[model samples]
Target: MTDSNAALNAFFKDFAQNLGRLQKGADVIAGIRDSDVDVGSTPKRLIQRRDKVELFRYEPEVEQRIDTPVLIVYGLIGRYTMADLQPDRSLVRSLLAKGLDLWLIDWGQPGRNERWLTIDDYVDDYIDEAVERICRETGHEKITLLGICEGGVFTTCYTALHKERVRNLVLTITPVDFHADVDDPAAHHGFLNVWTRSLAPEDIDRMVDALGVIPGEFMSSIFSLMTPMRSLTKYNVDLVDIIDDKDKMMNFLRMEKWLADRPDHPGAAGRQWLRELYQENRLFEGKFELSGRVVDLGEIDVPVLNIFALDDHIIPPTCSKALAAKVGSSDYTEIPLPGGHVGLFVSSKSQGALTKSIADWLQARDG
Candidate 1:
């Protein structure tokens, strides 16, 4: 016979244990971006806040700083903070500490005005507009554009749509080619295509109409199903570990905070992207048209650096490798890392080597 008190104690004990885990911050899980943190008396240079994207520009103090200005384009599907996730495990921080001048685009939470915004709005209106702004402000003719994941697709389209404007392009863990099988074997396998497509415009409209913003958890669940084990098992492990870590707990909370955020994907824009990019694979074949211009891969005349993760389940090698043949630029090169899709930017194992390689490659071409 088991003691009733011991069983009840166990249930209540875990609740207390959960409280302890909530406080320890580990693995640099804190979501504070270095740029946003105002360290007392720290010299600040150029930081421009845009209506859509926040620009964080860090000036280099090293002698003879590189001439080419680097602009980072993070994925829009998630928060841009992943690049600067941890204090030690950040791409932007690492780049800045190395004396590289940088400007990052933080596409702010989309509002009602931005509803129905499409890839065209991202590539043509915002990115193109940002490129011109950066060029004019920095007194540079061209920019070294770096894009990741869906952001990479946006960048590639920008390169194709506006061939002459970009100097050098760097794609990190980008899904340049998504027509083939997904990198992950367990992903939804087009379940989203069917479900999202089957969703009537009114269905989408009813939700967004009822709710001012699209629920973040709803969007996250869609992505989380890609790796069922990740959602099921990862949380269990965290429950045990986070029992005593408030900071870690907060860090977890922050990531959860970011994960729960789901700004509405404009109804019209979402339909086009889901149908064209994912459904029909129009980007590679030059069939995609936006704002009266065709997105031809052959128009990518600038030098390009494509980085794909060998072990990434989200964007397999095939997804990015198609860039080798699709581009018109002779200066195309590809680097495949051992990290996963998001690990290319956030994980500790890849940060040092990957960031160095990126900077070195850009420097070689720009020089």
Candidate 2:
């Protein structure tokens, strides 16, 4: 073949590939327009509700379940829907399949009305009330508590305050030692920690007061900035790689959907979290208090399972691994899974192992 014919063939091949990708992209867009994409599809019932808090009990998939129900508390900034992002890739579904009775505490999007709400209200009132309701419904005095990220911090505080109520405590990507950076600056990863610590207390107060309720979009933007190049690369380079595969594209869309659905955080709560926990690094030092009660980590006596993402950019592993030394629990287990903060739960590669570890730990303590 002549050089001209070879060049023509190369051009034709390139055109065909581009044409195929465009057709696939069109199909994806059409599916989105038709509202065919679904997430958080697992069935659940609202067992109890108070203020903006809703306690949902997921329908059991297995006939036989552990006696102690597992209650999941998600971080305030993000919606709980990520756990049940899809039917096949849902952490809730996986746990339920393992015969674990699951429940979730949904702190609905806080508006201007909730500007006065603080950590005291969330931990003392909302979570306390939910736990009591769960006990009443299941006839189990002590239940398993699983907290994710900031939710883990809340659960750790709750378990410390009411150790008798929590049979087992699980914290995923939880930041326990706010000052982990002080001991080893190099190990102190996550731009969030450094950024918050760099801010003055008055600065945080001014920002919170002006906003009334911190906009979810503002928070999302800050997180995206942590890896600005990667965020851009996802849409520019990675999107094209998975566009032809419907299943992969759907998975990517589900994650994007979850990230886009961030909820506004209450102003008062936001201020307290930044000032007391992040800036002052008080939680581990027993200086943090909720409703006049000191949150002493040493008070935690329940079996604690601390799971940290090895490559967590939001919360460093050292920050999470500090739980074992601080908590008074004799049965403390720490797992360093391979993934980022969110990947620990949703990544197909890690979710199964993560789910199994949780279920097995809970089952072992069920008796």
Candidate 3:
């Protein structure tokens, strides 16, 4: 009788607590507004504009400790806004607080009219122009080039070709060897690499020709397929678990906002990305060309800082770590952070380490 009574009391307590949580969750959901979930709230000023491409310099938060300005080059696939998602959890803010002068290129939303834009145009023209402008503005002969993902490929190529213009090179989650993922021990790692290699060259041409630009929706769908289980359960399971927590809910909504704002990739660039880089693996093989000149990775002799997420499924550790052997830099340094691709920038656990590592590395070479 005593055992039965205790069991009944425990069950009732759990049931009551669950009911209270459900009520709180409902109230939280009812109160959320678009303004309450704002992201990329860091202050910045646009300093240069060319067609759809714009360059912005972040306002310094402290006395600039580094004389050389650091230009952040984010991939065209995703917006640079990820670095500045929120004030407290921002890579931008943290770097600024550390007294680093920061600037970034915003490859503003590409459309049908921008379909003809190619990798050559981006590397030789736009990035070059940005570098020249930064040099003139800061009166520094060479500026540090910090690239993320695909942008790292561009910066690497740029550094190789124009070694005189770059003082330091920093790459985060950048894949130097597209085919390296085949050796990844984790089964789910490098889904993009496998999927891209599966498609024929003709298939890429057909898709680009038909669409003129790869729709953001199509790219988002591909990313979703990379983690099918997570895609299915994210809303129903993940969101529900944190619905009553304001901080977690805000983070979730901000990420969703960022994900939803994916820009359509220009057709010509998309074809080259999928074909020459992904399918043929030309970039790693030293056959990839930008503006009629071959991009040889070994030609990049600048002090290189390569950062990779240990469990990055998209880029994969093997793909990113391969840079250690390929670069000619005697000062090559690698940091393997714990988390997924996006988590390296946004996760609270990873942000402090990521920012501090970058600041300390850059400061060491600032002279």
Candidate 4:
């Protein structure tokens, strides 16, 4: 063949291969959309609801269930569905399989009217009611509290204020000491920590006031900005790489669905979080108060299991490691999982490790 003819053949071959891959990827995506790919498929009953807050109890799967039910407190920023992303990769399912009764608090998306809702409302009102209702139904005074990320901060506060209400505490990727970056520069690796710390208290107030209720998409965008290169590659390079693998593609899409489904945050609560915890670093100082009551971590003498993602960009290990020293609990344990923030719950390898560690720790203490 002539030089031009040879070049044309090579180009056509490459185009044909690329086209075939694109067609396969599109077919897989279409199938995923039409198929019964259920997320958060675990059965649960809504036992109680107060305003936007809802308390749900997952149906028991074991012959003999644990007396203490674990109440999961996911951050208000994202829905709790992340813990139950899919049947196989679900933290909920894993815990259920281990014979632990599970309960979850879903703080539904905040609206414009909810702009007035403060951190006190979440900690003092929603969390308080949920815990009491769980206690009332189970005929137990204290229940195991599992908090994730920002929810961990709230749980820590609640545990401190009402030590009698919590049997055991589990915090996953929780940022206990917001000023951790100040003490250790390694914690300053994440953009979120550095960005929030740079903002002034007045700046936080002004931003919150300007936005009646912070949009969930806005928050999602900020998280995406944390790893700009990774975010960009997910749509381009990563998607192409996993296009042929239907299982992997489905898992990726499921995670994308969860990430897109962010919840608007209450303006008042946002202001307090940014000002008191992020900006002023009042949490570590024991100066952060909810409804006039100080949230002193030293008061949490209950058994504590604090988990932090070693490779988490959003919440550095230093931010969560401080929990071991701050809490008054003699049975405090910190597990640094090998994954990113959200990956700790969904990643196949980490999911087993995460659930196993949590179950074993809780079993040893509660039994």
Listed in order, each prediction's TM-score against the native is: 0.79, 0.95, 0.95, 0.94
Cα lDDT over the full model 2:
0.86
Ranking by lDDT: 3, 4, 2, 1
Q: What is the lDDT of candidate 1?
A: 0.70
Between which residue pairs do clashes occur in model 3?
Answer: none
- Tens digit of per-residue lDDT, candidate 4, span 100-124: 9899998988888899999899998
- Cα lDDT, model 1, residue 7: 93
Error of 1 at 220 (Å): 0.5
Give candidate 3 regions above 4 Å deviation: 1-15
Worst 10 residues of 1 by lDDT: 35-44
Which candidate gets the maximum lDDT versus the true structure?
3
Off by over 4 Å in 4: 1-12, 34-37, 183-188
Worst 10 residues of 3 by lDDT: 35-44
Residue 366 lDDT in model 4? Answer: 76
- Ten-residue region with minimum lDDT total, candidate 2: 181-190
Worst 10 residues of 4 by lDDT: 181-190
lDDT per residue for candidate 1 within 195-230, as digits (tens), equals 554556566657656554455457778778866787
Q: State the lDDT of candidate 3 residue by residue for 119-186, as single tens digits.
A: 99898999999999999998999999999999998898899888999999999999989999998899
Query: What is the clash count of model 3?
Result: 0
